[model samples]
Target: MPETSLVTARERAVALLGGEPDDATLRRYLHGIPGVDAVGLEQRAAGLGTRSIKTSSKAWALDRIISLIDLTTLEGADTPGKVRSLVAKAVNPDPADATTPRVAAVCVYGDMVPYAVEALGDAHGDPDAGGVSVAAVATAFPSGRASLEIKLADTAEAVAAGADEIDMVIDRGAFLAGRYGLVFDQIAAVKQACLRPDGTSASLKVILETGELVTYDNVRRASWLSILAGGDFIKTSTGKVQPAATLPVTLLMLEVVRDWHLLTGQRIGVKPAGGIRASKDAVKYLVTVAETVGEEWLQPHLFRFGASSLLNDVLLQRQKLRTGHYSGADYVTID
Candidate 1:
């Protein structure tokens, strides 16, 4: 939707709710959601993934994938040096190919946000400014087990350190146990925590840990819950789960986003994290996003890929597309 006719996000959300956010209303609305048809959903996803892109579109898709990457590093062994290296690659993905597009952001741990911000230097603004953003995983990421106060503190510190985005994990345990209100409250709180002293808030990407959600119905519910709680993006996983991201799950989430846009005229973002390691697979996701949402959603704001090794594969494929043959392993740096 265009920016001019759009109402405030808060106004749209309130209109959707019909009243203030509370446990009873949340439960009634979520439970009232239509159940997913697993068989039909899987078939639709399969069909979309099988649609092949022509050679002309493949080149564009490769570059789009590069721009949508979050360039993530969330391991325990992460260091300031590693983050700087990651930021360097994010800024100039292919040193030999200056034309290669830079990635969207460098995602790091909360404590490492400062180093990422520092390393990004002048090239650390919006993608439109020819700069890559610094995204941080906060609120006890990948495992939302911390208290509400701790989660807010985690979010605040990252925002203070200058993270452009916050990828927070929702408490799946609460969601699973039918404590929908608890999960709702926590996500809303974390969204508030992302607010900066300067009045602008960091974008909030609510991680559903979809693998743990187990059912497509839960994925749908959680997607709606996160959006209702003011998440700028609804993410799939934490990269620590068995099934990090899959076409079917991502397609389902996109469907929710599509529906929300239909009702509110506001478009939310979606990030499919983990297990997307190949350029070809990434192309399939691009196709999914375009077909499901629209061609415009291929941009950095509406969609993102939480990836570590995906960039290398994309860079290699990019070289092949330009040079007409696959490049050697040494061409792209290995993470």
Candidate 2:
């Protein structure tokens, strides 16, 4: 907390919380940082989502950006009715707005993948008929406080159940306790368990629970660690806590992703989960990806929103443009 030792305090805080600070801790530190007032975080968010670069390779990057938008929702105990309702809303979307880019995947918890897969079959009638990939939250969700054997089994089950991607949370307690190598190995083992039926692997999104990790520095460090350990995507939160995904934390992640891409030449993804509720907020995130990571990450593969109530607003905005008037709120269901 000392001015001359902010850096040291940050290191100590990261150490105190175990090697990986969760979102709650990270947000506290972010708010406590001198000169990073509420407005500063918002300003940082505004700036991080708006950069675009023109290059001879711009067209190629644009295609990559288009592929990175994952529209996600992982409710605690979804039923077939709920899955049907969600799938209907996702696939039909706004008939008046059929041309908008579809999300990369529909993320749900493990129990719902079968329902999702069935719904996709009923509606779209083909493996890829549904407009999104089936992403599952596995390996001891919200709280990564499970044993390794159970965690690996969870990962294997989800992939076997047809999850195209796996979002696994790191064991915060261990990471915060300076067991960096252990956390890294945990991620590696889980990633290995997410292999596809063809022996290829499902893409792995390691949720740092940035809020828990507690600092931009740790978030950055975790970003590098996850990538080094083979994370296909570095997500911001589990949507389990108060500060589950905020603009400032996301900017830090994007900056890390951008730099990592440069250093490793291996493209990684970014997903900001929790508390995003409006189309404007979604666009703000898109803007942040474009500006900070460049246009390369604008797509769902590189970018996504882990939200339950966001799609309605996106549909609302799209419908407003089509009908020249706002539809009654009662008509919206993705909420």
Candidate 3:
């Protein structure tokens, strides 16, 4: 389809959900989604994982991986000083090498958005000017066990505090209990709460928490549910749960986003957070994206790795590529 037609289709999809959808309407929409083939899905992801990327291509992939990182720090003990340090590292990932590109954004809890924004300075205003964006994890994050009113308020506070992006978690209980309408409504409500006072809202990334979903079929369903609810991006995990961001899970998400774009002409991003700590692992994800979704999704806006230590490993690999030798842990700053 033509690009213009694709855009129109996506716009129409969003417009169609302008009003509150009834339970029956949501059920019919969800039930209409095709089932996933677990064996086939696993095979495809495993096959892609074995593909080789070498030399110059590897270097290019490493750099691209750095740019796609959402240098994250979501801990109960998080402080302004720690956030500032993280922001500094994000702005200049490779302090020794000025040629290295900055990370896409710094992801923190809602309360830390102001500190991150302040520390980031002009980069927050103009990401193209070597600046980074601030993403806040809200909506009873990691676990959507709160009331809808509280969740919406959490999202609104983040956006109001200068968060350029909001990463929200869906109520897995509602989803598992076949409460598709409730899940859809919660996501739509959060999306609405993302809207800023100036009419420019933070981009919404709905985290499906695939590990808890138990099956590939559920992951596929959750992906479609988020898309239909107007999520700008569909994420795999919150990084708090075990078995986060696995190759097969991320691969499935990539496929979903690819299919969603083809069907709607509106491109949605994918983020594989948690457990992706190595440079090699990050490259494998890049390979999967290039092969599954094409190079267009290679940019930071369309792809992001939700990680903290992953940045250090990427920097080390970059140094090795430039110097033909390995660098020590001391070389990179600790997040």
Candidate 4:
């Protein structure tokens, strides 16, 4: 086949799966996936971390980082007022500065989706506007210990409540127990539940929660498993785990997405959640995306940072770039 035809064929095959997999077939596929080399992966990540981005480029990256944030608040004590405030912050990250770009999405718990949708309506004319997608964490979020039925319902409720994106967690217990098929099927089912009554489906982000996975090889396997099961984005963590979203873990995920695109002609996204607090750390992630997967994944459609405090630090950096001095916490909203 011609190269173009081959690419088209692979895309067609991937689209047919729609994020679910046939049990036996998916199991066989999972078994065939190769493992990762811990030393090589960590060395590459460390080397990439050493690349210095200059002043102008750093300013450009700060702006892009602002746009890529999935400003999140997934606490049990979350209230409607808190969700509304977060929605406001997501719509306008910097009230004092008009040049600052809006975040990619506002991620909240399933129950808060309605409140976020309502609050965001005044900010943007359409709920599905590209400026800020309302993402909800479902599937027993943070811990994927719920039954499959409850998890699917959790996803459906979020979608029905007006979420444009669904971030679901994979069952680490099942994965660790060698029940790859169960993990694959649960993600597939949740992906299907993301469909709205109007036939549109919210983008599905499968959170691997790499902190619990314990090894680079497991992370690689989970990343590929999520992709083959129809995940639009493979996320690094739920932000609840201790070692969430480290450089090496995220680097492995970036490599997987890059390789998946090469093999399937489908481009999946990556989000590194938890512990990515500083502007410098965010810039390092952007550098990884640019170097590992090229500039195409630099956009919000293919990349995201699932963070809350990272936004304010990014705002501070943006201010520094604009006025040549550091800004205080009072300059940015306290969401």
Candidate 5:
């Protein structure tokens, strides 16, 4: 939109939020955005899923999917050895095939950041630099029930431990209770906490846990709230929730990102985490990104898939494409 257009979605957003928004301003801004068209969104997402990828395109998609994965291991039993293994996978992905592209990052809990960083060594820096990044889950991941002080501390510790990115979960309870201000403040504060002792800050990915969000409209609101609060990426889940990362939910988020770009010329990242285990399913999400927000978002900086078993499936599919048949279980690692 033209800067001088006077009336745009962003301008409306600014006006709704006011200067330092109170509860009324928060509700007004969040509730003011266009409500989701549930049926239309779902049908469009399904249509995108059915779109075909030819042989050559499928090969390219397979590699692109590999590059876009945030190979994750977020469990209570997570060990340093497991994190190193995850890092090794992120750095190599398929050891037999040297040509196989490395993944974007290895996501682990905050305490494991050091191990992930240690294992990555010099190969851990920037994803765009042909290196793997270490992402840490913080802010009471998948729960977001802790105090703001604790949440900020969680993010700070991850950044201090050399995490390249911080995936912080928002408080679904507060969001569901219509406490938009509380959620907004928490996100904004966490974003600040991502800043390092040095000038550079770790990129913050806000997890909405869309499964608990209940409605598409709620997802839309949470996406906007995350961006407006300075989130580097709006994520769909923490991999602990059910019904995570559906095509329709991801499509809705991409639409919001598309609109944000059009309105303000700012491109925000989107991540669909969990429940996406198949190569075919991952390809569908790739198609959705291209169709919804354009192929520019196909890059690692703009899109990511959070999954533990997803890389295994992508690797198996890659081997099949090369040898014309599925490989044995040994071809991929067990997460």
Candidate 6:
């Protein structure tokens, strides 16, 4: 396929972001959304310990967990070393501080995957070491405004450079303009490029940037469309928007996947990125999956938390449970 025109694509993406939604559609998206209930959400977030233990055991035993921890702290150019250390910590967790769950993979921007892959390679001797998969953000990430060819080549290069997973954002503009076929074709092409040189395929995660879509109906339609178009996972955001990943939005996507699975007998994954900072917040997302998507999606293959700061709180909470002391500075900062 020829490269899409970048100038045109960017204009289309922006227009879609600013478009209006009608009444019934707006109502559907807002369905059952509680009053921004963080307290209630936290109350529902009680199972982090059980979830973490389950993740560790499943990963150790059946390798069912995604065992994921993400790093998209793109500060300056000195990021390679930072990412390498982050990956290392996720694998060989600090023994003194037992809060970090064994992550299944280390995810970074496309430019940083090679550094993480090398670090993970150095730490490959540990049993914890084997779970180190790599995921790279592609397709003009936070803003899905790149040409289709650039997106495909971006995915291809990441896979070739050793990313075990490719997370691409759907062109929300196309979907908003009622061009579902264009969006679908773009995703399919990228999925094709995600294939390894020898014909194996890396996991392909499609980020809908749900907040950008701005309505529940759009979120639902995008979710369903993404799954039908061959998305192995449907992610919530680029973590760069005002409303990155919200429970209500995730709830909507959960329904889409639930119905999709019922209809097609195929399970798709969910990733809620952006604004997920605290360990409690991460657990809330897991609880949402467990309650809405069923106990099965709680495992990593069907679920993952995409955040840079979340691991520390998870680790801190874990340490408090294990050693009975709330020692601060238990984890290294991503910055």
lDDT of 1 at 203: 89
lDDT of 4 at 168: 94
RMSD of 2: 9.8
Task: Give the winner by lDDT.
Answer: 1
Residue 58, candidate 6: how far off, in angstroms?
Answer: 16
Per-model TM values vs. the true structure: 0.93, 0.76, 0.90, 0.89, 0.92, 0.75
Which residue ranges in model 2 land beyond 4 Å of their true spot? 1-43, 46-73, 95-101, 122-130, 326-335
What total of clashing residue pairs does each candidate reach?
A: 0, 30, 1, 2, 0, 8
Candidate 5 vs 6: which has more lDDT: 5
The TM-score that candidate 4 achieves is 0.89
Model 3 deviation from the true structure expressed as Cα RMSD, one decimal place: 4.9
Q: Each candidate: what lDDT?
A: 0.86, 0.66, 0.82, 0.81, 0.84, 0.66
Worst 10 residues of 2 by lDDT: 1-10
Inter-residue clash pairs, candidate 3 = 123-131
Cα lDDT of candidate 1 equals 0.86
Where is the poorest 10-residue window by lDDT in model 1?
1-10
lDDT of 5 by residue, 216-272 (tens): 999999998887777779999988889889999999999999998897677889999
Score candidate 5 by TM-score against the native. 0.92
Give lDDT for model 6.
0.66
Best by TM-score: 1
> Is 1 or 6 the stronger prediction by TM-score?
1
Q: Deviation in angstroms for 220 in model 3?
A: 0.6
lDDT (Cα, 0-100) at 28 in candidate 6: 39
Task: Report the lDDT of model 3 for residue 86.
Answer: 96
Candidate 3 per-residue lDDT, tens place, 105-125, comes to: 999999999999999987785
Order the candidate numbers by lDDT, best to worst: 1, 5, 3, 4, 2, 6
